[model samples]
Target: MNTTISKIHPKEIKKVTLGAGAISINEIIAVSRYDAEVLFSQDYRERVNLSRSVIEKFLDEERVIYGVTTGFGSNVTETISTEDAEVLQKNIIRSHAVSVGEPLEKEVVRAIQFMILVNLGNGFSGVKLATLELLRSLLNHQIIPFAPGEGSVAYLAIEAHMALVLMGEGKAWYNGELIPGNEALEKAGLQPVSLGCKEGLSLINGSTSVTAFASLALYNSIQAAKTADIAGAMSLEALKGTIKAFDPRIHSVKRHEEQAITARNIVKMLERSEIVEKYKDYRVQDALSLRCIPQAHGAVKKVLKDAEFTICNEMNSTSDNPIIIPEDQGDALMVGNFDGTFVGIYADTMAIAMANLAKVSERRLDRLVNYHVSELPNFLVAKPGLNNGYMIPQYTAAGLLNEIRVLVHPATVDNTPTSANQEDVVSFAYFAAKKAYQISKKLEYILGLELMAAVQALDFHQPLKPSPVSQKVYELIRSVVPTVEEDRYFYPDIQFITNLIHEGEILNTVELIIGKLDW
Candidate 1:
């Protein structure tokens, strides 16, 4: 399946329905990046009302509920009367919405909003139906809250910032202008929602922020994995590597699904190549980086698949602190679902996986540029000493790889207690997801460098021509970056190829020709 979301024109996409267990990465990307409208289903409204009625009955009976008729965290023992419930909810929003740091990207905030909306739509959070509609209004109107990138241990801090926007208390971007949340809501013909029956606690008590980050990173990493295969194939042609290593017969015995798929993709991409066929018996075996693209890249693929499974599961689940069970007659059950340990650990795993991908890509770039390994012109330039072609890009890749190494340290393993030890043991899943996002970006750039070098080396093969698929990739690359007969400014070349990778042009073009590769 092609999990990659293509960049669609904003006007082409229609309003999508969001609900529990139905939110997809494509849907999130559609609403967030493509500005598609969203609608809350009538089913969600009915469910919300049923859940709300339970809470209302409890309130009428003077029953104490955690974070509702009582204070939050360590203050849970302090009970409040019905008259003070609204004030408690509002105060939680006011005190908890203290996130500081650089503002999160618009796309991240949009995803967070979508996840929160979906979590509440699960009909277990005890928020009023009107409050859910208000969030839907924000999504449909393209009013994005200015959520900060830090101050989240679970998701309370960031979710508070998002909820504040609904209350018209935070900042938001509307019509491409950053304005007060109140003004944005007014301009969008929407009004701030009032807290009623656990609305404020329901709004901010979830793991939506880390879930959104992991979801976005999973999509990007899948694309990066496929691009790595394409770039690896190009490098194979440049080095005249043996396809014997990627033979299905060789991979079948190992029985690793991702490895076999990657080996099969390498074979398919390099099919009918005169270059690969010409050097049938020149060497016994290639080096590990060249010979084991399937092993390294395939391991990353497995890791991504695991993280995808974990994240999608998280998306379907309600991560709220105290879940309202309408089936149990609206009883609020306090649970630890809000803890983001699963997302944090899996996201950390993905960070290591992406870092490994970057490491191999950087080393492959080394192999392409070094004459000792590639047997191409020194520095891949005809006049090696004078025009240092692609020499510095390898160093750049190395530096990026070094940074990835540092980022791969498990954020989950290091936890700080928050909320007065009432919430002891925090999950830094947000930081883990953030680092994975950063690693994926650098991974794309590193692959771009490899593609640039591989194409340069393949040019030396002359009119021999590459595999039909490789020829298309080479031509597409040349369309943006010409053959480097001599080095002019190379940064522009890197930038263009990086853009190609990021824009999914290269992946889209190759998949168009060769069909979809195994994810």
Candidate 2:
């Protein structure tokens, strides 16, 4: 009874200030998904101005800097005069903007633009202050660049598309219409600036695009991981399974932090359940799906934690090439900081972990509806044979599970060289993060089906009630969907529960009953 949790409504947030490395995923979601205005502090603007001064001085002195004086990739040996520095920046934006596929989601485009803006605000990219402001204008005015969803090995293609929009070239989304970037700028009452010094290289040279997607993906996965636990607890009560396996003593011996956390959450959720107390069924021990909820979901939690660390660090740290050392003053250190190995590896790990979570959820859904295993009414329907009940949902879950399983193949393993072998051994972290995003959606649907079936089974428990947490979750579902006395178009019922899971309504209701679920 001593918990204090503060929640921010995304829609109500009006502004997000950026500087250095302090932005969290919530802030990103507010600006990207909720149209929150982006602002930079005076100190942030000064830092950018100072960094731009360094590059301008270098340009004045004709000091040779990688990606500034020389051509990009294999042509770095070809140097450019100060007169051509601006043109060099422009050409890179045009040349690298080769992403091909359907345009990225509007929120994703905003997130990408925001990430770019934040990185430049960090003052290590050697971009002009005006260029950074232009990026901010695109974000604030809601003119999203039409960045494609494909062709990125390490955020290059997508970011290039974003940079093109800044140059008044690429297509943009403005006023609910996809228009040319120049037109979008005109309507937004903004003008594009010509790239100068290292602006072009700086814009497309970093891993912001992949990091942006990874950051958002990590946020969503963490949400799904917590919701998965709630679904497991609800399934446990509905199936009349004991909480013996979640005993602290059993988990204390292993000392796996995530597993212990998950066990504690389950224990708290099923604290005073009548269903669990009267659960001496056919078998003394339940299947692994019921018995190892903590262990399985705990593994997923660990992966998500690792991903959060990697992504947040990437968000704060500058992932640019030839990073402008503000402290060192005019020294552009050329290094391979742009390598996305950490993001790629952790994203793959998260994908595999999520696939495992979904696999167990599918089996648990099997236990809820298939009467041979659940001992509940067949399909949890009043007339199983007449209506077909909740039979096809499990099949849908199975199909989604199969897709998730196939996506677990690590994208970092196969590296095809790009930029003419100058960029050999690329980390396809974008695809890995993208795959995790896809898996999270699929897993949500699978868990949604499980939640729907579990709530239906709880209806049969009747006089015997679920725990406080599960009861609240059941009521939240019933608020959106009536009890499935007979299967009326079950897809809508499944979708309603899925929306609850995705929108955090069910998780919020359950957490209110029993403090916050384990991370």
Best by TM-score, which number? Answer: 2
Q: Which candidate wins on lDDT? A: 1
lDDT of 2 at 417: 87
Per-prediction CA RMSD (Å): 2.4, 2.6
Please estimate how well model 1 matches the true structure, expressed as its whole-model Cα lDDT. Answer: 0.85
The residue-level lDDT of candidate 1 at 188 comes to 92
lDDT of 1 by residue, 1-519 (tens): 333334452335666686523566767666776767888777877888898888888889888789878899999999988999898888999899888898988888888888888888888888888888889888888888888878777677888888888888889999999999999999999999888858888888778888888887877787889999999999988898988899888888986899999999999999899999998577899988889999999999998888877787788789886788888555788888887889889989999999988888888899999998788888899998889888999999999888889989988898788768887778888888888878888888999999999999999998787999999989999997988888889888999998888767888888888887776
For model 2, what is the C-alpha lDDT against the true structure?
Answer: 0.84
lDDT per model, in order? 0.85, 0.84
**TM-score (all chains, Cα) for each model:** 0.95, 0.96
Residue-wise C-alpha lDDT for candidate 2, range 314-378, written one tens digit per residue: 77778888888867546888898888778888888888988898999999999999999798989
